[model samples]
Target: MELGLVGRTNAGKTALFNLITGSTAEVAPYPFTTREALRGRAEVPDPRIDAIADIQDIPRRVRAQVQVVDIPGLAAGAGQGEGLGGKALGELRQMDALIHVVRSFANNEVAHPEDAINPLGDAEAIDIELLLADREQIERRLEKVRKSAKSGDATAKGEQGLLELLVTEIDQGNPLRIVGDAEALALGIGMGLLTAKPVLYVINSDDPGEPLPELVAYATSRDAHVSQLAVGTELELAQLSPEDAAELAQEMELGDVRGADAMVRAAYELLDLVTFFTGSGPPEARAWPIQRGLSADKAAGKIHSDMERGFIRAEVVAWDALVAAGSFSKARESAQVRMEGKDYIVQEGDVMQIRFAV
Candidate 1:
């Protein structure tokens, strides 16, 4: 899965990216600090993997990961190819979702294009740019589709109708996300419309507290998720030793869950993903992120094509069950493991061992 961090310049997107990816990409107090898209992997931290490894005495454990891209900040007229806006929007097209970093704090050293701390307004600005980009794209495609439809191509006719509806929606200030028609939404997503993608709004607050009600309402109206983080504090925490960071975080009443971890978890949920495990291993114990409701055989394909091609059953047990039983053998003896067929739907935290022939 891929996610892109997008917002106006100096919204602390680079700082948040550093906190989440542990990469020291240069962060300056100016717009467009990130001139090019910076890519990194964020390991989805699951304690269940650790527990499985501990109980099974596995030598290595690998957590599932998400690919994150930090695109340069966008400005007004970005849709018309303003500074770095063209490149930024191009990168956003490749993302499965967007993590919008709206500036909610006042920083004298940093400069905001609007020169104000209105998170809601900042979010709206980004949304409008995305809408403009999509509108241009759709209009261009619609012109060709209109010509094709005139030739009596049924598929082209259908697409032409949908595109016209989408144009109407966009012109009326309605994002494609709120099109209210399944076919239209799916078509928009298929066309890679920016407003059609899932969004997670991250409020970069100086004193992180309850997110502003205006921003929350905006997200709710658009069927999106919203979260807040003190990016400055989290970046500082990231610089400290783990032990010292924990102490200071405790002192700051930030609670046990780190901002990066929470953001990653929310990203997974936004993508409708579930994590499964392969627990019986001397070489490795690993967590696998898969789309929810994926069948057993397809999930095995994630590990290796040979496993899925062999076509066999999977011995599945819950992570906690395997840990409580002390070992896979013990778990089998206790009837904690089930022989699941290839059609079985994989569940979250399921520790699966495929029994297949070569």
Candidate 2:
């Protein structure tokens, strides 16, 4: 999965990206610091994966990873060639979900675009640009579908109606996310509408323990989610060595933690993903991120198409059960491993070994 970081200039979007990605992509007080999209892989830190590896005494353990892209900050008139312009907006369409960084912390040096710290207003500024950009996209696509609709194609007609509704919704200063059954909207996913993506609002604050009412209300109103973090502090911590960082955190009364884990975990949950293990005792053990409720045959395809094509059964056991049973041979002896077919739904924390012709 690829997640995009977006917000207006100087909203700490880059700071959050740097913190989570351990990337020194350059964070600045001004806007548009990131002109080109920077890609990074963040390992989803799951102790369950670690525990399984420890129990199996594997030589290597690989955590599931997600790709993150940090794009340039947007501003008013971005849809019409403003800050970052079309290039930035196009990247937004490619992301699986959006991590909207809002400026909630007060710092005199870094200037807010509106000259004040109003998170709701900041969100509105970003949302308006997204809406206008989507409008331009829908209108252009609407013309092609309209021609098909003129030919009395029912599918085309339904698409035409939905596009018109979307245009009206944008014109009224409302986001497409508020539209019910948004996923079913005709040409919605194909159109890559920015407002339709899931949003996670991260408030750049001094005291993350205390919630910001305005920001929280804005998220609730949009049916999205919110999180808090001191991005600046986190970014600084990320630059230190693990030992030094832990020492400093201890001195500051901070617990054993890292900001990257928190951010990645939230994004994983937001995307509704589950992790399953592959390999028992070997040179390597790995965690694979799969969508929840994926059937055994389809989930195997995620690893390799050959595995799915071979048409074979799988030996599956819970992570804890496998660890308790000590090894695959031991698990079989204890009847802890189940023989699963193609229709079996893979559960989170399941460790599987497939028997296939391929």
Top candidate when judged by lDDT against the true structure: 1
Each candidate: what lDDT?
Answer: 0.89, 0.82
Candidate 1 minimal-lDDT segment of 10 residues:
263-272
Query: Model 2: residues >4 Å from true position, as ranges?
Result: 81-83, 171-173, 182-186, 291-293, 304-306, 309-311, 323-330
Tens-place lDDT digits, model 1, residues 1-358: 8999999999998898888888899999966778999999877778889899997789899998888899999999998777778888989988899999999888888898977788898999999999999999998899999999999999999999899899999998887888988898899999889999999999999776778888899999888999988999988988999999999989998886777687777876677788899968677999999998999999999999999999699999999999999998999999999999999999988999998889
Please provide TM-scores, in order, for all candidate models, with all chains considered together.
0.93, 0.89
lDDT of 2 by residue, 1-358 (tens): 7889889888987778777777778877765677888888777788877777787788788888888898888878997656567899989899888888888889988888888988888888888888888888898888999999999999999888888888887788767777775543535656778887888888887654545787788888877888888788767677788888888778766677655577678887667787889867787788989989998888888888988898599899999998888887899999999999999999989998877786
Question: Poorest 10 consecutive residues of model 2 by lDDT?
Answer: 181-190
- TM-score between candidate 1 and the true structure: 0.93
